[model samples]
Target: MSFQSLQLAPELDQALATLQFSVPTPIQQQSIPLVLEGHDLLATAQTGTGKTAAFMLPILHRLLKEPEHNGKVRALVLAPTRELAQQVAANSEAYAQYTGLKVACIYGGANISPQEKALKAGVDVVVATPGRLLDHLLKGTLKLDKVSHLVFDEADRMLDMGFIGEIKRIMRHLPEQRQTLLFSATLDEQVQKLAAQWLAKPQRVGVDPENSAAEKVEQLFYAVDDDRKRELMSHLIGKNNWQQVLIFTRTKNMADEYAKELNKDGLPTLAIHGDKSQGARDKALAQFKSGKTRVLVATDVAARGIDIVDLNYVINAQLPFVAEDYIHRIGRTGRAGKAGMALSLVSIDEQWLLEELEVLLDERLTPQWLQGYEPDLTKVPKDNRKNSAKARKQRDKKHILGKRDQRRRKK
Candidate 1:
């Protein structure tokens, strides 16, 4: 029930106390003992469920007992994105502070020189994105042969981001006898197959069911035309006096556009996406987190990336193409058993996205219309051009053709 009961080393216990972590989350409680006993683990837990500490604490405890490998990474944590990798590294540093364990983080966007220097100098643990880590491994600058502990944090997202090949290549450099842990929010087919092929006799631990959102998250949908979504969101923020908000758009351009328009509406806003340099993204995140910016517009690149523990509001200005991503977007809020609000601005064209979420969550979702923001029924909204029957047929044709092209490539 408590961190003390986990029987962690005095240093770890004291670190947890300094961080004010009194109780272990469910995933932590179930996975820590098994990890300490040296079992490979497959844990199904969402990001904000304190899953980071669940695996990191025990791994730190074990690593503290061994002498640091001068140039070899003794413990490795693989993340999907730069943001996520940095977050894990931050936590690892905080937890390992008293234990004298050093941590290094490597990802694609930042300069690789510093990462290479860190690896050359030495670190007890390395948290990295698969692509950047693969680069290090290929260059012979980093070796994981001595790694006793490995963690796949957000396995599903890594796979979804098309990093499976890179992950597999990275794994080739690791020894088979090491302890492996795979953590995913959902045990989908891809993640399941990865677990089957990887973890050896792993203990399966789950504190939440598949595709389930946090219980305390208050979800609501606003039915407005696509064209007026920005207006509605600005109005809501201004009327409700929302100081901090995270809004998700479907594309990088949309993110930039939304940020621009919202700023024009007198709301301080910034956009972060793949197009931005890592420094710019980091600055944007800093501003948003520091409450200097009122709204942060982001693409799905940040759905699992941002780790604001006390974030109170999440808005889906545009629905994600993948229905399940709805869960990840809303997950930015309502973390760690905290009460939060997740609002989606749904348009006529995105009804399919909403429906898919319903099927995923196994529940019905009703969209509410604000009086002044409602789409004028008599007048056709511009979204009709994309959602019309003819448009649907065209989209279907493209999808079919794309699949045929994929099959042709396989041939």
Candidate 2:
């Protein structure tokens, strides 16, 4: 159904039409009506399912009818990362432009002075990262006492990034009586607990099955030795003629090293990580998104902020320790109903990570043996590597130990 059927205001309809968004995404289709009806919502959908607009539209509609008073924050959107906060702010601005709604963004890594100035000027909507917003609260620069609508975009990621404490702290500041919406790609037990604590009889809406990747993405894994991973990557990129590739490494140093190696091989490559200045990260991201650079190597932190359309491939140079991250990594490709590919080079050391990822996906990844890149069977695999079946058992062992340690620490 079209966005108009959701009973949005005429200005919002015009905004959607002007932006050429004629058809609503599945998440938007399911969640918009419930949000418009003034109910708290917990929605689970993949990253690129237009989940941002689902809540944004309804919030915009509410704001349009309400009067904006000085020092009153009507809507507050808490994002996990600076990039996400900026993105939400941009979306808010785009959707609210027609109604002349004022939007302000607050996040770390920029001048606090400017953000403080904006908050004092009184914006109708504030898109902020939890930590930075808390900073404003402590400094008496921002107030959430008047906030009537709240959104925790990327709720799972916020928890992963250790923002749970900040999120709970923010809750204390917000009026107990308000509309709360928590959206995530997946809702784990922790997220569920938060939902129980925060949302009031919320409507639970999930457009797709939990932790399912897009059908358009062709996922493949290559078995290669740790030493030969870089070689395999260069060969695959050359053989496949991949124009735009997003490569994920486990660490910042690895990202930089791989990018340098790829550049030396005549492929224009760049790396984005926490070590680099924000200016450098932004520049590299722009080049990669514009397709001016053929390869962009990034650590997990860098991956969260960079969004490119029609990205052809995502290469996992080093698998993530967290299983959910595997889903988000491949998600960078296959966005906006587009076909894409996710290729992973798994060394002997990362077999356990691989197994956990497979369990999370509920499907084993098909191993494709590339010619000349086959793993050596003669050598005993390192301690870090275990066969897929063994890996699951190992993970369980660790979990048991972790629980024991928690109890001991408490005692």
Candidate 3:
């Protein structure tokens, strides 16, 4: 359905029109009305599902309706990483442009003095990371007494990062009577516990099942030796002439090393990770986004906040340790309903990790061997092959039993 049917404010409707956002995504269609109705909400949707707008539009509308000038922070949005905070703040600014709302994004790894100044100047909405927001709160640079709306964007990620204590501390500062919204890519046990504690009789909205990647993403993997991963990646990019690619590595050092190797092979590349300063990270991101750098190598921590328009390729130079992160990594591509490709370069050592990812995805990923770079399967550890064979037999047995049961039912 069109966004107009959601009954957004006139100014918001104008903003949406200007942004060419006419149709609502599934998450937006289901959650916007519930949020506008003043109910606390618990939503689980995959990345690239327009979840930011689902909450931002309604929050901006509520702030405009109330018109609070006292400036004690009417709406607080807590993101897990600096990049995500910046993205949410950007979206908030765009959607609230016509309404004349003040938006400030605060996160660590940057100059906090300026953030403190912005908070002092007064803002209707504050999007911040948990650690940095707590710093401001403890330093008496910000207040949440007037906060009527609270949002935990990427709640699962925050919990994974061990920010649960910080989030709980931040919650203590907000007024007891408020509308709370928790948006997560997955509603696992940890997220459920957080919701139980925070939300007050919330409306549940789930657009897609947990651990599912975007339907438009074409997922495939290349089998190579650990030492040949970089060589294989370089060959694929050069052979395919990939213009803009976001590559995920498991560690900061790998991200830097991969970017350097790719650049040495005549590909303009940049690396972003936690070790880099905020200015450096921003510069690298801007370069990648502008196509000045054709490749951006990033670790899981640094990659959380990357939201680029038309980013068509996401390469897993190294598979994530957590299976769910595989979903988030590929999600960087296949955004805004566009077709995209997610390629993983799997080595012998990463076979176990790939198997875990397949279990989470509930489907087997067929492995492809590059013509010249095919891995030496004979060198794979005997134990690994044995385990793989055993797992395959179990799956075959289960499939045969299911088929037999279906035949019996028909008879």
Range of the 10 consecutive residues with the lowest summed lDDT in candidate 3:
399-408
RMSD of each: 4.6, 3.3, 6.1
The better-scoring model by lDDT among 1 and 3 is: 3
Who wins the TM-score comparison? 2
lDDT of 3 by residue, 286-339 (tens): 999999999999999898879986999999999887667888899898888899
The local distance difference test score of each candidate is: 0.84, 0.83, 0.87
Q: Per-candidate TM vs. native?
A: 0.92, 0.93, 0.93
| Evaluation by TM-score, superior candidate among 1 and 3 | 3
- Model 2 scores worst on lDDT over the 10 consecutive residues at 399-408
Rank order (by lDDT, best first): 3, 1, 2
lDDT of 1 by residue, 90-128 (tens): 988999989877899988978889989988888889999
Candidate 3 residue pairs in backbone clash: none
- Return whichever of 1 and 2 wins on TM-score: 2
When 2 and 3 are scored with TM-score, the better candidate is 2
